[model samples]
Target: MAATAEKVKRGRKFAQVLEGARQVFLRDGYEGANVDEIAREAGVSKATLYNYFPDKRLLFLEVAKAECQRQADEAVEFDDGSAPPDRVLFAAGRRIADFVVSDFGQGVFRICVAESDRFPEIGQEFYRSGPGLVRRRLADYLREAVARGDLEIDDIDLAADQFAELCKADIQTRRVFRLPGCRSGETLDRIVRGAVEMFMARYGVKKGQTKA
Candidate 1:
Protein backbone atom coordinates (compact mmCIF):
# COMPACT_ATOMS: atom_id res chain seq x y z
CA MET A 1 0.00 0.00 0.00
CA ALA A 2 1.02 3.61 -0.51
CA ALA A 3 0.76 4.27 3.22
CA THR A 4 3.05 1.34 4.03
CA ALA A 5 5.60 2.51 1.47
CA GLU A 6 5.51 6.00 2.94
CA LYS A 7 6.08 4.61 6.40
CA VAL A 8 9.02 2.55 5.18
CA LYS A 9 10.57 5.57 3.52
CA ARG A 10 10.14 7.59 6.68
CA GLY A 11 11.76 4.85 8.73
CA ARG A 12 14.79 4.77 6.46
CA LYS A 13 15.09 8.55 6.64
CA PHE A 14 14.83 8.41 10.41
CA ALA A 15 17.62 5.86 10.58
CA GLN A 16 19.76 7.95 8.27
CA VAL A 17 19.27 11.02 10.44
CA LEU A 18 20.22 9.07 13.54
CA GLU A 19 23.37 7.73 11.93
CA GLY A 20 24.42 11.20 10.90
CA ALA A 21 23.54 12.68 14.27
CA ARG A 22 25.57 10.01 16.03
CA GLN A 23 28.66 10.84 14.02
CA VAL A 24 28.20 14.55 14.60
CA PHE A 25 27.64 14.15 18.30
CA LEU A 26 30.67 11.88 18.65
CA ARG A 27 32.88 14.13 16.53
CA ASP A 28 31.73 17.52 17.83
CA GLY A 29 30.31 16.77 21.27
CA TYR A 30 26.82 17.92 22.20
CA GLU A 31 27.83 21.50 22.92
CA GLY A 32 29.65 21.89 19.66
CA ALA A 33 27.41 19.89 17.32
CA ASN A 34 25.07 21.78 15.02
CA VAL A 35 21.79 20.80 13.38
CA ASP A 36 22.91 22.17 10.03
CA GLU A 37 25.92 19.90 9.92
CA ILE A 38 23.84 16.95 11.07
CA ALA A 39 21.30 17.56 8.34
CA ARG A 40 24.00 17.93 5.72
CA GLU A 41 25.78 14.81 6.81
CA ALA A 42 22.59 12.82 6.84
CA GLY A 43 21.89 13.94 3.26
CA VAL A 44 18.51 15.22 4.33
CA SER A 45 17.09 18.67 4.26
CA LYS A 46 16.98 20.75 7.42
CA ALA A 47 13.22 20.42 7.36
CA THR A 48 13.45 16.66 7.28
CA LEU A 49 15.91 16.62 10.17
CA TYR A 50 13.64 18.80 12.22
CA ASN A 51 10.69 16.66 11.25
CA TYR A 52 12.34 13.62 12.76
CA PHE A 53 13.97 15.31 15.79
CA PRO A 54 12.59 18.55 17.15
CA ASP A 55 15.86 19.44 18.83
CA LYS A 56 19.43 18.35 19.30
CA ARG A 57 18.79 17.11 22.83
CA LEU A 58 16.17 14.63 21.60
CA LEU A 59 18.47 13.53 18.83
CA PHE A 60 21.30 13.01 21.28
CA LEU A 61 18.95 11.06 23.52
CA GLU A 62 18.06 8.81 20.62
CA VAL A 63 21.72 8.36 19.79
CA ALA A 64 22.55 7.50 23.39
CA LYS A 65 19.68 5.04 23.58
CA ALA A 66 20.70 3.41 20.32
CA GLU A 67 24.26 3.02 21.48
CA CYS A 68 23.17 1.54 24.79
CA GLN A 69 20.75 -0.84 23.10
CA ARG A 70 23.41 -2.00 20.64
CA GLN A 71 25.94 -2.64 23.38
CA ALA A 72 23.38 -4.44 25.52
CA ASP A 73 22.26 -6.62 22.63
CA GLU A 74 25.79 -7.56 21.63
CA ALA A 75 27.43 -7.86 25.05
CA VAL A 76 24.90 -9.22 27.52
CA GLU A 77 24.11 -12.71 26.28
CA PHE A 78 23.07 -15.34 28.82
CA ASP A 79 22.25 -18.99 28.23
CA ASP A 80 18.75 -19.36 29.58
CA GLY A 81 19.88 -19.26 33.24
CA SER A 82 21.93 -22.41 32.75
CA ALA A 83 25.36 -20.83 33.25
CA PRO A 84 26.88 -20.52 36.72
CA PRO A 85 26.39 -17.21 38.51
CA ASP A 86 30.07 -16.41 38.50
CA ARG A 87 30.39 -17.07 34.80
CA VAL A 88 27.32 -15.06 33.85
CA LEU A 89 28.05 -12.14 36.13
CA PHE A 90 31.68 -11.98 35.13
CA ALA A 91 30.84 -11.99 31.45
CA ALA A 92 28.26 -9.23 31.89
CA GLY A 93 30.56 -7.20 34.12
CA ARG A 94 33.49 -7.37 31.76
CA ARG A 95 31.45 -6.30 28.79
CA ILE A 96 29.86 -3.42 30.72
CA ALA A 97 33.20 -2.24 32.10
CA ASP A 98 34.83 -2.41 28.71
CA PHE A 99 32.01 -0.49 27.09
CA VAL A 100 31.98 2.15 29.81
CA VAL A 101 35.69 2.74 29.37
CA SER A 102 35.72 2.69 25.61
CA ASP A 103 36.32 5.90 23.67
CA PHE A 104 32.78 6.12 22.33
CA GLY A 105 31.23 5.43 25.70
CA GLN A 106 33.46 7.94 27.42
CA GLY A 107 32.58 10.53 24.83
CA VAL A 108 28.87 10.03 25.30
CA PHE A 109 29.22 10.08 29.08
CA ARG A 110 31.23 13.28 29.01
CA ILE A 111 28.60 14.94 26.89
CA CYS A 112 25.90 13.98 29.36
CA VAL A 113 27.92 15.25 32.30
CA ALA A 114 28.89 18.44 30.57
CA GLU A 115 25.36 19.29 29.44
CA SER A 116 23.51 18.07 32.49
CA ASP A 117 23.57 21.44 34.24
CA ARG A 118 22.29 23.26 31.22
CA PHE A 119 19.99 20.47 30.03
CA PRO A 120 19.09 18.12 32.84
CA GLU A 121 16.85 16.03 30.63
CA ILE A 122 19.88 14.79 28.68
CA GLY A 123 21.37 13.26 31.81
CA GLN A 124 18.06 11.70 32.79
CA GLU A 125 17.62 10.23 29.34
CA PHE A 126 21.12 8.81 29.33
CA TYR A 127 20.62 7.29 32.77
CA ARG A 128 17.33 5.71 31.80
CA SER A 129 18.68 4.30 28.55
CA GLY A 130 22.14 3.26 29.74
CA PRO A 131 22.98 2.38 33.33
CA GLY A 132 19.37 2.18 34.45
CA LEU A 133 18.50 -0.37 31.78
CA VAL A 134 21.60 -2.38 32.57
CA ARG A 135 20.82 -2.41 36.26
CA ARG A 136 17.29 -3.67 35.61
CA ARG A 137 18.58 -6.49 33.44
CA LEU A 138 21.13 -7.42 36.11
CA ALA A 139 18.43 -7.42 38.75
CA ASP A 140 16.37 -9.79 36.67
CA TYR A 141 19.32 -12.13 36.48
CA LEU A 142 19.92 -11.87 40.21
CA ARG A 143 16.24 -12.60 40.93
CA GLU A 144 16.50 -15.73 38.80
CA ALA A 145 19.67 -16.80 40.59
CA VAL A 146 17.92 -16.32 43.90
CA ALA A 147 15.01 -18.46 42.75
CA ARG A 148 17.46 -21.21 41.79
CA GLY A 149 19.17 -21.00 45.17
CA ASP A 150 22.37 -19.84 43.56
CA LEU A 151 22.22 -16.61 45.55
CA GLU A 152 20.73 -15.64 48.91
CA ILE A 153 19.89 -12.06 48.10
CA ASP A 154 17.63 -10.17 50.50
CA ASP A 155 17.20 -7.32 48.01
CA ILE A 156 18.01 -8.27 44.47
CA ASP A 157 17.81 -4.68 43.21
CA LEU A 158 20.27 -3.40 45.77
CA ALA A 159 22.57 -6.34 45.13
CA ALA A 160 22.47 -5.69 41.38
CA ASP A 161 23.41 -2.03 41.85
CA GLN A 162 26.20 -2.96 44.26
CA PHE A 163 27.61 -5.58 41.93
CA ALA A 164 27.61 -3.12 39.03
CA GLU A 165 29.35 -0.53 41.18
CA LEU A 166 31.85 -3.16 42.25
CA CYS A 167 32.66 -3.94 38.64
CA LYS A 168 33.53 -0.28 38.04
CA ALA A 169 35.86 -0.25 41.06
CA ASP A 170 39.06 1.51 39.93
CA ILE A 171 38.31 1.57 36.22
CA GLN A 172 35.44 4.03 35.69
CA THR A 173 37.03 6.85 37.65
CA ARG A 174 40.26 6.54 35.72
CA ARG A 175 38.48 6.48 32.40
CA VAL A 176 36.28 9.45 33.29
CA PHE A 177 39.33 11.46 34.30
CA ARG A 178 41.21 10.52 31.14
CA LEU A 179 44.07 8.91 33.00
CA PRO A 180 47.10 7.73 31.10
CA GLY A 181 47.05 3.97 31.28
CA CYS A 182 44.97 1.80 28.97
CA ARG A 183 42.26 -0.56 30.29
CA SER A 184 43.75 -3.89 29.41
CA GLY A 185 41.68 -7.08 29.39
CA GLU A 186 43.63 -8.49 32.31
CA THR A 187 42.78 -5.52 34.47
CA LEU A 188 39.11 -5.71 33.54
CA ASP A 189 39.08 -9.45 34.21
CA ARG A 190 40.63 -8.90 37.62
CA ILE A 191 38.06 -6.25 38.50
CA VAL A 192 35.14 -8.44 37.37
CA ARG A 193 36.56 -11.42 39.23
CA GLY A 194 36.89 -9.40 42.40
CA ALA A 195 33.34 -8.05 42.09
CA VAL A 196 31.89 -11.49 41.42
CA GLU A 197 33.78 -12.92 44.39
CA MET A 198 32.50 -10.23 46.72
CA PHE A 199 28.95 -10.58 45.44
CA MET A 200 28.99 -14.35 45.77
CA ALA A 201 30.56 -14.15 49.18
CA ARG A 202 27.73 -12.00 50.43
CA TYR A 203 24.80 -13.64 48.62
CA GLY A 204 25.81 -17.13 47.57
CA VAL A 205 24.16 -20.00 49.41
CA LYS A 206 25.43 -23.41 50.37
CA LYS A 207 24.09 -26.51 48.59
CA GLY A 208 21.05 -27.17 50.74
CA GLN A 209 20.44 -23.78 52.28
CA THR A 210 17.12 -21.99 51.84
CA LYS A 211 16.65 -18.20 51.85
CA ALA A 212 17.86 -17.42 55.36
Candidate 2:
Protein backbone atom coordinates (compact mmCIF):
# COMPACT_ATOMS: atom_id res chain seq x y z
CA MET A 1 0.00 0.00 0.00
CA ALA A 2 2.98 2.26 0.48
CA ALA A 3 6.12 1.90 -1.62
CA THR A 4 6.43 -1.25 -3.71
CA ALA A 5 7.44 -3.91 -1.17
CA GLU A 6 10.20 -5.69 -3.10
CA LYS A 7 13.51 -4.09 -4.02
CA VAL A 8 14.45 -5.82 -7.23
CA LYS A 9 17.09 -4.39 -9.55
CA ARG A 10 15.35 -2.14 -12.04
CA GLY A 11 16.19 -1.43 -15.66
CA ARG A 12 14.54 -0.88 -19.00
CA LYS A 13 12.99 -4.32 -18.86
CA PHE A 14 11.81 -3.91 -15.29
CA ALA A 15 8.24 -2.98 -16.17
CA GLN A 16 8.23 -5.45 -19.02
CA VAL A 17 9.24 -8.27 -16.75
CA LEU A 18 6.66 -7.25 -14.18
CA GLU A 19 3.90 -7.13 -16.76
CA GLY A 20 4.85 -10.59 -17.93
CA ALA A 21 5.14 -11.79 -14.37
CA ARG A 22 1.69 -10.42 -13.63
CA GLN A 23 0.16 -12.25 -16.56
CA VAL A 24 1.88 -15.54 -15.83
CA PHE A 25 1.37 -15.27 -12.11
CA LEU A 26 -2.32 -14.56 -12.61
CA ARG A 27 -2.70 -17.25 -15.21
CA ASP A 28 -0.77 -20.15 -13.63
CA GLY A 29 -0.35 -18.98 -10.04
CA TYR A 30 2.88 -18.81 -8.09
CA GLU A 31 3.89 -22.47 -7.94
CA GLY A 32 2.52 -23.29 -11.36
CA ALA A 33 4.21 -20.33 -13.05
CA ASN A 34 7.49 -21.28 -14.72
CA VAL A 35 10.32 -18.77 -15.02
CA ASP A 36 10.73 -19.54 -18.69
CA GLU A 37 7.06 -18.79 -19.33
CA ILE A 38 7.34 -15.48 -17.56
CA ALA A 39 10.42 -14.60 -19.57
CA ARG A 40 8.75 -15.58 -22.79
CA GLU A 41 5.60 -13.67 -21.88
CA ALA A 42 7.70 -10.61 -21.14
CA GLY A 43 9.78 -11.14 -24.32
CA VAL A 44 12.99 -11.16 -22.31
CA SER A 45 15.76 -13.68 -21.91
CA LYS A 46 16.14 -15.91 -18.89
CA ALA A 47 19.38 -14.14 -17.96
CA THR A 48 17.68 -10.78 -18.16
CA LEU A 49 14.77 -11.94 -16.04
CA TYR A 50 17.11 -13.38 -13.41
CA ASN A 51 19.14 -10.20 -13.38
CA TYR A 52 16.07 -8.20 -12.40
CA PHE A 53 14.54 -10.76 -10.08
CA PRO A 54 17.04 -13.17 -8.57
CA ASP A 55 14.39 -15.16 -6.75
CA LYS A 56 11.11 -16.26 -8.23
CA ARG A 57 9.47 -15.84 -4.85
CA LEU A 58 10.56 -12.20 -4.79
CA LEU A 59 9.06 -11.70 -8.18
CA PHE A 60 5.81 -13.17 -7.05
CA LEU A 61 5.87 -11.07 -3.92
CA GLU A 62 6.38 -7.95 -5.95
CA VAL A 63 3.44 -8.87 -8.13
CA ALA A 64 1.25 -9.53 -5.11
CA LYS A 65 2.21 -6.20 -3.60
CA ALA A 66 1.37 -4.43 -6.83
CA GLU A 67 -2.00 -6.15 -6.90
CA CYS A 68 -2.82 -5.01 -3.40
CA GLN A 69 -1.85 -1.48 -4.30
CA ARG A 70 -3.99 -1.66 -7.39
CA GLN A 71 -7.00 -2.76 -5.43
CA ALA A 72 -6.44 -0.03 -2.87
CA ASP A 73 -6.19 2.59 -5.56
CA GLU A 74 -9.33 1.38 -7.34
CA ALA A 75 -11.41 1.02 -4.19
CA VAL A 76 -14.33 3.41 -4.08
CA GLU A 77 -14.92 5.81 -1.21
CA PHE A 78 -18.58 6.93 -1.21
CA ASP A 79 -18.19 9.58 1.46
CA ASP A 80 -18.56 12.60 -0.79
CA GLY A 81 -22.26 12.17 -1.51
CA SER A 82 -25.48 10.34 -0.75
CA ALA A 83 -25.17 7.30 -2.90
CA PRO A 84 -27.80 4.77 -1.87
CA PRO A 85 -26.52 2.33 0.72
CA ASP A 86 -27.80 -0.65 -1.21
CA ARG A 87 -26.00 0.41 -4.38
CA VAL A 88 -22.84 1.32 -2.55
CA LEU A 89 -22.69 -1.92 -0.60
CA PHE A 90 -23.46 -3.96 -3.70
CA ALA A 91 -20.67 -2.28 -5.62
CA ALA A 92 -18.28 -2.93 -2.77
CA GLY A 93 -19.42 -6.53 -2.53
CA ARG A 94 -19.01 -7.06 -6.26
CA ARG A 95 -15.52 -5.64 -6.25
CA ILE A 96 -14.50 -7.77 -3.28
CA ALA A 97 -16.06 -10.91 -4.71
CA ASP A 98 -14.46 -10.39 -8.09
CA PHE A 99 -11.01 -9.96 -6.56
CA VAL A 100 -11.40 -12.93 -4.25
CA VAL A 101 -12.19 -15.19 -7.17
CA SER A 102 -9.46 -13.76 -9.39
CA ASP A 103 -6.14 -15.52 -9.91
CA PHE A 104 -4.14 -12.55 -8.66
CA GLY A 105 -6.16 -12.40 -5.48
CA GLN A 106 -5.80 -16.15 -4.98
CA GLY A 107 -2.05 -15.84 -5.44
CA VAL A 108 -1.82 -13.08 -2.88
CA PHE A 109 -3.56 -15.15 -0.22
CA ARG A 110 -1.68 -18.32 -1.08
CA ILE A 111 1.71 -16.69 -0.89
CA CYS A 112 0.86 -15.15 2.46
CA VAL A 113 -0.18 -18.53 3.84
CA ALA A 114 2.71 -20.46 2.32
CA GLU A 115 5.36 -18.02 3.52
CA SER A 116 3.81 -17.22 6.89
CA ASP A 117 6.16 -19.53 8.80
CA ARG A 118 9.27 -18.17 7.16
CA PHE A 119 8.12 -14.57 6.75
CA PRO A 120 5.35 -13.49 9.07
CA GLU A 121 5.57 -9.91 7.91
CA ILE A 122 4.47 -10.91 4.44
CA GLY A 123 1.15 -12.02 5.79
CA GLN A 124 0.89 -8.96 8.01
CA GLU A 125 1.73 -6.67 5.15
CA PHE A 126 -0.86 -8.33 2.97
CA TYR A 127 -3.48 -7.92 5.64
CA ARG A 128 -2.63 -4.26 5.99
CA SER A 129 -2.74 -3.68 2.27
CA GLY A 130 -5.62 -5.94 1.34
CA PRO A 131 -8.21 -7.25 3.80
CA GLY A 132 -7.39 -4.76 6.53
CA LEU A 133 -7.71 -1.84 4.16
CA VAL A 134 -11.06 -3.12 2.90
CA ARG A 135 -12.41 -3.49 6.41
CA ARG A 136 -11.36 0.03 7.39
CA ARG A 137 -12.90 1.66 4.33
CA LEU A 138 -16.06 -0.39 4.45
CA ALA A 139 -16.47 0.41 8.10
CA ASP A 140 -16.07 4.07 7.36
CA TYR A 141 -18.75 3.85 4.70
CA LEU A 142 -21.09 1.92 6.97
CA ARG A 143 -20.65 4.47 9.73
CA GLU A 144 -21.65 7.19 7.34
CA ALA A 145 -24.59 5.19 6.10
CA VAL A 146 -25.81 4.84 9.63
CA ALA A 147 -25.53 8.58 10.15
CA ARG A 148 -27.55 9.11 7.00
CA GLY A 149 -30.32 6.85 8.29
CA ASP A 150 -29.62 4.41 5.51
CA LEU A 151 -28.56 1.59 7.78
CA GLU A 152 -29.07 0.38 11.32
CA ILE A 153 -25.96 -1.01 12.94
CA ASP A 154 -24.69 -1.04 16.47
CA ASP A 155 -21.15 -1.83 15.45
CA ILE A 156 -19.86 -0.50 12.19
CA ASP A 157 -16.64 -2.50 12.31
CA LEU A 158 -18.42 -5.76 12.94
CA ALA A 159 -20.93 -4.99 10.22
CA ALA A 160 -18.12 -4.30 7.80
CA ASP A 161 -16.51 -7.66 8.58
CA GLN A 162 -19.82 -9.43 8.25
CA PHE A 163 -20.55 -7.93 4.88
CA ALA A 164 -17.10 -8.86 3.65
CA GLU A 165 -17.56 -12.43 4.81
CA LEU A 166 -20.98 -12.58 3.27
CA CYS A 167 -19.48 -11.71 -0.10
CA LYS A 168 -17.22 -14.78 0.13
CA ALA A 169 -19.95 -17.21 1.01
CA ASP A 170 -19.65 -20.46 -0.95
CA ILE A 171 -17.37 -18.66 -3.37
CA GLN A 172 -13.87 -18.15 -2.00
CA THR A 173 -13.27 -21.68 -0.65
CA ARG A 174 -14.57 -23.45 -3.73
CA ARG A 175 -12.62 -21.21 -6.08
CA VAL A 176 -9.49 -21.38 -3.92
CA PHE A 177 -9.38 -25.18 -4.19
CA ARG A 178 -9.97 -25.11 -7.96
CA LEU A 179 -13.20 -27.05 -7.72
CA PRO A 180 -14.70 -27.52 -11.18
CA GLY A 181 -17.41 -25.15 -12.45
CA CYS A 182 -17.30 -23.08 -9.29
CA ARG A 183 -16.60 -19.84 -11.13
CA SER A 184 -19.54 -19.55 -13.47
CA GLY A 185 -20.36 -15.91 -14.04
CA GLU A 186 -23.99 -16.42 -13.19
CA THR A 187 -23.12 -18.22 -9.97
CA LEU A 188 -20.81 -15.40 -8.86
CA ASP A 189 -23.50 -12.85 -9.58
CA ARG A 190 -25.94 -14.76 -7.39
CA ILE A 191 -23.44 -14.99 -4.54
CA VAL A 192 -22.60 -11.28 -4.55
CA ARG A 193 -26.25 -10.27 -4.81
CA GLY A 194 -27.16 -12.66 -2.02
CA ALA A 195 -24.46 -11.16 0.16
CA VAL A 196 -25.79 -7.65 -0.35
CA GLU A 197 -29.35 -8.83 0.33
CA MET A 198 -28.38 -10.48 3.58
CA PHE A 199 -26.42 -7.49 4.80
CA MET A 200 -29.25 -5.15 3.94
CA ALA A 201 -31.79 -7.30 5.73
CA ARG A 202 -29.68 -7.01 8.85
CA TYR A 203 -28.72 -3.34 8.60
CA GLY A 204 -30.73 -1.62 5.93
CA VAL A 205 -33.31 0.86 7.15
CA LYS A 206 -35.31 0.32 4.00
CA LYS A 207 -34.52 -2.65 1.84
CA GLY A 208 -33.80 -1.70 -1.72
CA GLN A 209 -32.94 -3.50 -4.88
CA THR A 210 -29.19 -3.89 -5.41
CA LYS A 211 -29.46 -5.51 -8.80
CA ALA A 212 -27.56 -3.84 -11.59
Candidate 3:
Protein backbone atom coordinates (compact mmCIF):
# COMPACT_ATOMS: atom_id res chain seq x y z
CA MET A 1 0.00 0.00 0.00
CA ALA A 2 2.75 2.43 0.93
CA ALA A 3 4.74 1.70 -2.24
CA THR A 4 1.68 2.17 -4.42
CA ALA A 5 0.90 5.46 -2.73
CA GLU A 6 4.48 6.60 -3.23
CA LYS A 7 4.36 5.77 -6.95
CA VAL A 8 1.12 7.69 -7.38
CA LYS A 9 2.56 10.70 -5.55
CA ARG A 10 5.66 10.69 -7.74
CA GLY A 11 3.53 10.45 -10.89
CA ARG A 12 1.43 13.42 -9.84
CA LYS A 13 4.54 15.39 -8.91
CA PHE A 14 6.07 14.73 -12.34
CA ALA A 15 2.90 15.89 -14.09
CA GLN A 16 2.83 19.12 -12.09
CA VAL A 17 6.48 19.86 -12.86
CA LEU A 18 5.99 19.06 -16.56
CA GLU A 19 3.06 21.48 -16.80
CA GLY A 20 5.05 24.24 -15.07
CA ALA A 21 8.10 23.67 -17.26
CA ARG A 22 5.99 23.99 -20.41
CA GLN A 23 4.65 27.37 -19.34
CA VAL A 24 8.12 28.62 -18.44
CA PHE A 25 9.66 27.34 -21.69
CA LEU A 26 6.86 28.90 -23.71
CA ARG A 27 7.16 32.22 -21.91
CA ASP A 28 10.98 32.54 -21.76
CA GLY A 29 12.15 29.96 -24.28
CA TYR A 30 14.74 27.22 -23.68
CA GLU A 31 17.76 29.55 -23.40
CA GLY A 32 16.17 32.06 -21.04
CA ALA A 33 14.20 29.70 -18.81
CA ASN A 34 15.80 28.61 -15.52
CA VAL A 35 15.31 25.57 -13.32
CA ASP A 36 14.59 27.55 -10.19
CA GLU A 37 11.79 29.49 -11.84
CA ILE A 38 10.28 26.28 -13.17
CA ALA A 39 10.42 24.70 -9.74
CA ARG A 40 8.77 27.72 -8.17
CA GLU A 41 6.06 27.71 -10.81
CA ALA A 42 5.53 23.96 -10.28
CA GLY A 43 5.19 24.45 -6.53
CA VAL A 44 8.14 22.22 -5.90
CA SER A 45 11.61 22.82 -4.52
CA LYS A 46 14.57 23.03 -6.88
CA ALA A 47 15.69 19.74 -5.40
CA THR A 48 12.35 18.23 -6.22
CA LEU A 49 12.61 19.33 -9.85
CA TYR A 50 16.03 17.74 -10.06
CA ASN A 51 14.71 14.57 -8.54
CA TYR A 52 12.23 14.31 -11.41
CA PHE A 53 14.07 15.76 -14.44
CA PRO A 54 17.76 15.80 -13.40
CA ASP A 55 18.41 18.81 -15.69
CA LYS A 56 16.71 21.65 -17.54
CA ARG A 57 17.66 20.16 -20.91
CA LEU A 58 15.73 16.96 -20.20
CA LEU A 59 12.78 19.00 -18.94
CA PHE A 60 12.65 21.04 -22.14
CA LEU A 61 12.96 17.87 -24.19
CA GLU A 62 9.93 16.48 -22.41
CA VAL A 63 8.06 19.69 -23.19
CA ALA A 64 8.83 19.30 -26.92
CA LYS A 65 7.80 15.68 -26.76
CA ALA A 66 4.46 16.61 -25.25
CA GLU A 67 3.80 19.23 -27.90
CA CYS A 68 4.63 16.85 -30.75
CA GLN A 69 2.47 14.14 -29.24
CA ARG A 70 -0.46 16.54 -29.12
CA GLN A 71 -0.03 17.35 -32.81
CA ALA A 72 0.31 13.69 -33.77
CA ASP A 73 -2.89 12.91 -31.91
CA GLU A 74 -4.67 15.54 -33.97
CA ALA A 75 -3.48 13.84 -37.18
CA VAL A 76 -5.62 10.83 -36.31
CA GLU A 77 -8.86 12.39 -37.52
CA PHE A 78 -8.69 13.01 -41.31
CA ASP A 79 -11.66 11.51 -43.10
CA ASP A 80 -11.93 12.67 -46.72
CA GLY A 81 -14.20 9.77 -47.74
CA SER A 82 -13.34 7.25 -50.44
CA ALA A 83 -11.43 8.71 -53.37
CA PRO A 84 -8.50 7.86 -55.61
CA PRO A 85 -5.47 7.01 -53.45
CA ASP A 86 -3.38 9.82 -54.92
CA ARG A 87 -6.20 12.28 -54.45
CA VAL A 88 -6.48 11.19 -50.84
CA LEU A 89 -2.74 11.75 -50.53
CA PHE A 90 -3.17 15.29 -51.81
CA ALA A 91 -5.86 16.03 -49.28
CA ALA A 92 -3.80 14.61 -46.38
CA GLY A 93 -0.78 16.61 -47.51
CA ARG A 94 -2.75 19.85 -47.55
CA ARG A 95 -4.10 19.21 -44.07
CA ILE A 96 -0.61 18.69 -42.69
CA ALA A 97 0.61 21.73 -44.64
CA ASP A 98 -1.96 23.99 -43.04
CA PHE A 99 -1.02 22.64 -39.61
CA VAL A 100 2.71 23.12 -40.13
CA VAL A 101 2.15 26.69 -41.30
CA SER A 102 -0.10 27.51 -38.36
CA ASP A 103 1.02 29.64 -35.41
CA PHE A 104 1.24 26.76 -32.94
CA GLY A 105 3.29 24.61 -35.32
CA GLN A 106 5.67 27.49 -36.01
CA GLY A 107 6.21 27.95 -32.27
CA VAL A 108 6.98 24.27 -31.78
CA PHE A 109 9.38 24.35 -34.71
CA ARG A 110 11.21 27.30 -33.22
CA ILE A 111 11.53 25.70 -29.82
CA CYS A 112 12.80 22.41 -31.24
CA VAL A 113 15.33 23.98 -33.63
CA ALA A 114 16.69 26.35 -30.99
CA GLU A 115 17.26 23.57 -28.48
CA SER A 116 17.95 20.56 -30.76
CA ASP A 117 21.73 20.97 -31.03
CA ARG A 118 22.23 21.53 -27.31
CA PHE A 119 20.53 18.23 -26.51
CA PRO A 120 20.62 15.82 -29.42
CA GLU A 121 18.44 13.34 -27.57
CA ILE A 122 15.69 15.94 -27.60
CA GLY A 123 15.83 15.85 -31.39
CA GLN A 124 15.33 12.11 -31.35
CA GLU A 125 12.44 12.45 -28.92
CA PHE A 126 10.73 15.08 -31.07
CA TYR A 127 11.20 13.00 -34.23
CA ARG A 128 9.70 9.97 -32.53
CA SER A 129 6.75 12.01 -31.38
CA GLY A 130 6.05 13.56 -34.79
CA PRO A 131 7.73 12.63 -38.08
CA GLY A 132 8.80 9.16 -37.03
CA LEU A 133 5.28 8.21 -36.06
CA VAL A 134 3.92 9.92 -39.14
CA ARG A 135 6.20 7.92 -41.38
CA ARG A 136 5.16 4.71 -39.67
CA ARG A 137 1.52 5.61 -39.95
CA LEU A 138 1.88 6.38 -43.64
CA ALA A 139 3.70 3.13 -44.19
CA ASP A 140 0.91 1.23 -42.48
CA TYR A 141 -1.70 2.97 -44.63
CA LEU A 142 0.28 2.22 -47.78
CA ARG A 143 0.66 -1.42 -46.85
CA GLU A 144 -3.08 -1.56 -46.37
CA ALA A 145 -3.65 0.05 -49.76
CA VAL A 146 -1.35 -2.50 -51.31
CA ALA A 147 -3.38 -5.33 -49.81
CA ARG A 148 -6.55 -3.69 -51.08
CA GLY A 149 -5.09 -3.25 -54.60
CA ASP A 150 -5.55 0.52 -54.41
CA LEU A 151 -1.81 1.14 -54.64
CA GLU A 152 1.24 -0.82 -55.70
CA ILE A 153 4.69 -0.37 -54.20
CA ASP A 154 7.63 -2.74 -53.82
CA ASP A 155 8.76 -1.18 -50.57
CA ILE A 156 6.07 0.29 -48.37
CA ASP A 157 8.41 1.94 -45.87
CA LEU A 158 10.47 3.83 -48.39
CA ALA A 159 7.34 4.80 -50.27
CA ALA A 160 5.90 6.20 -47.05
CA ASP A 161 9.01 8.34 -46.45
CA GLN A 162 8.88 9.68 -49.99
CA PHE A 163 5.18 10.40 -49.57
CA ALA A 164 5.83 12.50 -46.45
CA GLU A 165 8.63 14.41 -48.18
CA LEU A 166 6.20 15.14 -50.99
CA CYS A 167 3.89 16.68 -48.42
CA LYS A 168 6.63 18.72 -46.69
CA ALA A 169 7.74 20.59 -49.81
CA ASP A 170 9.64 23.76 -48.66
CA ILE A 171 7.28 24.52 -45.80
CA GLN A 172 9.74 23.75 -43.00
CA THR A 173 12.38 26.09 -44.36
CA ARG A 174 9.79 28.77 -45.03
CA ARG A 175 8.45 28.51 -41.49
CA VAL A 176 11.87 28.32 -39.83
CA PHE A 177 13.30 31.29 -41.74
CA ARG A 178 9.98 33.14 -41.66
CA LEU A 179 10.06 33.59 -45.41
CA PRO A 180 8.00 36.56 -46.52
CA GLY A 181 4.45 35.40 -47.35
CA CYS A 182 4.99 31.71 -47.94
CA ARG A 183 2.34 29.88 -49.95
CA SER A 184 -0.30 28.16 -47.83
CA GLY A 185 -3.87 26.86 -48.33
CA GLU A 186 -4.68 26.86 -52.06
CA THR A 187 -1.12 27.80 -52.91
CA LEU A 188 0.00 24.87 -50.81
CA ASP A 189 -2.70 22.93 -52.60
CA ARG A 190 -1.09 23.46 -55.99
CA ILE A 191 2.37 22.52 -54.77
CA VAL A 192 1.28 19.42 -52.84
CA ARG A 193 -1.05 18.32 -55.63
CA GLY A 194 1.81 18.43 -58.10
CA ALA A 195 4.14 16.61 -55.75
CA VAL A 196 1.61 13.90 -54.91
CA GLU A 197 0.76 13.35 -58.54
CA MET A 198 4.42 13.05 -59.37
CA PHE A 199 5.02 10.61 -56.52
CA MET A 200 2.02 8.48 -57.48
CA ALA A 201 3.14 8.43 -61.09
CA ARG A 202 6.47 7.06 -59.98
CA TYR A 203 5.38 4.58 -57.28
CA GLY A 204 1.70 3.85 -57.56
CA VAL A 205 0.04 1.81 -60.28
CA LYS A 206 -1.13 4.30 -62.87
CA LYS A 207 -4.44 3.78 -64.62
CA GLY A 208 -4.00 1.18 -67.39
CA GLN A 209 -0.32 0.81 -66.52
CA THR A 210 0.76 -2.84 -66.26
CA LYS A 211 2.01 -3.94 -62.79
CA ALA A 212 5.69 -4.68 -62.74
The most accurate candidate by TM-score is 2
Q: In candidate 2, how many Å is residue 87 off?
A: 1.6
Compose the digit string of candidate 3's lDDT tens values, residues 1-212: 11222222245588889889988887677999988899999999898888877667667766776776786786633333367677678766776677677776666666777767776665676677677776776777777777767777898888877877777778767876878665546668876888788887786776786644
Which is the winner by TM-score between candidate 1 and candidate 3?
1
Q: After superposition, how far is residue 55 of candidate 3 from its true place, in Å?
A: 7.4
Candidate 1, residues 1-212, lDDT tens digits: the string is 11222222245599999899988988788889999999999999999988777767677767776776665565455546889888998888987888778887787788877877876765676676677878888888888888887788888889989998999998999988878664988888889899999988888886666654
Q: Rate the local accuracy (lDDT) of all candidates.
A: 0.80, 0.80, 0.72
Ordered by lDDT, highest first, the candidates read 2, 1, 3
Report clash pairs, candidate 3.
none
Please, what are the lDDT tens digits per residue for candidate 2 over residues 63-88?
Answer: 77777678678765554446787788
Winner on lDDT between 1 and 2 is 2
Ranking by TM-score: 2, 1, 3
> Candidate 2 overall Cα lDDT vs. reference?
0.80
RMSD values for the candidates in order, in angstroms, are 5.0, 4.5, 5.2
TM-score of each: 0.77, 0.81, 0.70
For candidate 1, report its TM-score.
0.77
